[model samples]
Target: MDSAVGRCREIRLRAYPDGMIQPSDLTIIETALPEAGPNDLVVRNRWFRISISTRLMANPDAQAVEGIPFPALRPGDRLADGAIGEVMACPPGSGFEIGTFVSHPLGWRDYAVVDAGSCVALGRGPIEPAAYLGHGWTAYAALTRGIRIRRGDTVFVSSGAGAIGSMAGQIARRLGASRVIGSTSTPDKADWMTAELGYDAAILRNRGSIADQLKAAAPDGVDVFVDMVGGEQLAAAAEAAREGARFVLLGALTAELNVAGASIVAPVQLDSFQLILKDVTLRGYSADRDSAEAFPEWIAWQREARLHFACSTVAGLENAPGALHDACEGRLRGLVMVEV
Candidate 1:
């Protein structure tokens, strides 16, 4: 009989207090393989995986995250969120067939053993499956929730050229946003969004005050703000928001990363009580927390919503460290997927 062996890439946590992900924060341990138990299918290492919140990054009590339980991947860890590789073999009577590609929670490893119950077969799509994890779903979620982008309502998007941001802008237009104003830190990203991605208008954050830019960008005031990083931008969303506008606060990446940068920290003080008095609604969003039916409900609607995603893929399980570093540095966007 052939000896069964598996190579796995695992992330062991060290320590992180400032929310900055340091290289030493996670140790990648490669171990000898274990034979599949019971109905588990062993996927031959093809493309391991990379999701923004990798299983390791999400594991319970990740020091990098705020107030998480110790050892984050608790008994309730959701496997639907992870993706993996082609099946090398499945126990007889196991549902997965050899060569079938799968995405599951057993991530950060070259080879994964998934019970038939924990994984789902990938569906056919126009883009590569990696892109779906790296880019597709987050954008899918961002654009789907928020004030309706009806005709004549001006829309302002922070991180307009970012992984989820760029796709959100496109989807808003398709949903009938009259004017899509995108904000970026540099002219280069602004240009890319306009010249390449069909953006209606782009604003450079480096220019005059963000408030001024928004005023000029939307003389009528912005009806919606798709905010990914919520520091000053959250306050900016409040300032630039049209009366009764909705500010969708997503991830606070800027504040969470460079906590010292005043550009991100200062504005949140709120210029005055007039901001809240304006009747604007500011709500935070977490797409992962969904009702049982809600997941399928939106999944069905995305077909008509027409969302887009982008992914950066790295081959070989060992390259995950470099990939994570690139992602933390903003060199990579959307979802970073590693092929085990």
Candidate 2:
């Protein structure tokens, strides 16, 4: 153990958020570090991810979100998620050396005492600590395994400027899609998607009917739909889907983050006729299941600079709550991370 190490600061849920998360809903507290067990490693977290899933987990009433293995948080409980950290203390024979950077599940804190089995060593490389927190694997799995982006397919991703959606657009293009389109809340974000994220077109959800905008963007109809922000987007994508199209259901940000007291079962209206007449195949999968296979491929893409990591970074642990709030509210683009 480092002689200078002592107590650590962590963010905890102050209350279950009603709808939009506020900074006041979380509090930072100091506590003594836990004693390291024989198989445990103490780490100093460098960066922690702030995501919509974190927002969903903060809701005590929200049901267990699919694909997230962690339990829902209660008042005074520490917020936990993907984090990159340097090992400070580890038991002999733990196979992890001090100063090794590792990715773990304990986050929203300055330090963590995690099981050795849960930590994945990130060798010193050109990849930054924050890059390890990117949702590239999620996007990779959704594109490759969820539906398999076919050559010449026109793909539409909802919330294209989002953490996963941003990566989805680029990956879809790399997977041989002829045209990639994305829908975002603002024109600025839509422009960001088309200009920077390799999208052929961007649809502004705020400008007019999403269906109308999508129709104009893909007049030939979308061959693949990556539905992230459900509700209106899901309905619109269904309407604009081409014959024999594939729909990959990812997240439901609009209903989950916006509507107060909305359950995971929030109703998504889609035309049943479109599904049958167009022979559209809608599929949803847990990212966790595909991560094992997707991580290696995603890493290869990163090393080759074939993928772009769009990220918004906040400098302090104290600001994690507000960063998360921004992420949930669609103010931040791509993966939002906090430097702890």
Candidate 3:
């Protein structure tokens, strides 16, 4: 008999109505690996964890109507940062080897049994697998397809020290931007952007009206805006835009507020006038769409040195909560991972 069973843990979010998510909003439960059916591969589950966007709860008024192809929660499932694991066993006729390292779109669990087709093999490489979490597709999507950023353009990026933003700035520089101006909250991050990443300049976002500051910094005005903080930032980007700029809208960290009504939950609103007049293009991106092109492109970028990546290391399933707390509190930067 299988002794007892291989045990794994999962986090389930309670019904949170106010967009509130704390460590207590998560419930940790022990569960056993699913018995693999046909063509199933049971991974020993090495490293896996969550990102902040996936961990936050949403009220219906502010809830996204839908997300990408990631499966929705069942009766017992939850939304959290995902992880990578190693294949320890495979059912007969499954083509996977037992020792392959793979990443799947499952939550913070110790062991996972997934179909062979559901994962991407972590080939022997210099790039860390977890770096592929947000850093991989995100930077590629922003520059290549999302913004169509060109050489000799001026690019303005928000949250410039973050996982996606930092890589995006570097890619812009390599892709031949004449100048890359980034906005960060502190002098320390601004200095890091300029000195370490080869950025042309960085403005301290907390110091002044970002719109006026960016306008003052870019006498020619911005040609591309890779925006993460919406509301005032978006409004500012729109105002500071030169003729024919491409504004790639990626996030809304400043959008959500607990307004009394559905329409008012977010203070961020976009005016179509500037986009129409200045020949400015606004577009939103999700990585899963057209990943068929992105994956190979990403592999090439990393190989060619245009893309640099990093991740925060964690160990074991027991530390999931603490790791998540660290991520939330800004103690760790880049994508967070558990080494198992």
Best by lDDT: 2
Stretches > 4 Å off in candidate 1: 1-4, 14-25, 45-81, 91-94, 123-127, 205-208, 259-267, 271-277, 291-308
**How many Å off is the CA of 245 in candidate 3?**
0.5
Tens-digit per-residue lDDT, 1-340, candidate 3: 1226766666665444334344655567777667777877777666675565543333333334343343333324565445566777777666566777777776477677777887777743343664556565676677888879877999988877766677778878877789998877778777877877667888876587887888877878889998866777778878878889998877655532212311222356566787788999988765556444677677666767745564677776667767765665555645677766
Clashes of each: 13, 0, 3
The candidate with the higher lDDT, 2 or 3, is: 2
The residue pairs in collision within model 2 are none
> Which of candidates 1 and 3 reaches a greater lDDT?
3
lDDT values, one for every candidate = 0.60, 0.84, 0.67
Tell me, by TM-score, which candidate is best: 2
Instruction: Estimate, for each residue in 217-270, the C-alpha lDDT of model 1 and write its tens digit.
Output: 788788888887666666666777777776666656564345232122323566
Question: 1-340 in candidate 2: lDDT tens per residue?
Answer: 2347678888899998877888999999988878878899999898888877767777777556557666788898888989998888888987888987889999899999999999998865444654478877787888878887889999999988988888889888888999999988888887888889999999887688999998898999999999887888899989988999999988887766764743466478888987999999999866776456677676777666567788899999999989988887789998899987
State TM-scores per candidate.
Answer: 0.77, 0.95, 0.85
For candidate 2, the per-residue lDDT at 204 reads 86
Ranking of models by TM-score = 2, 3, 1
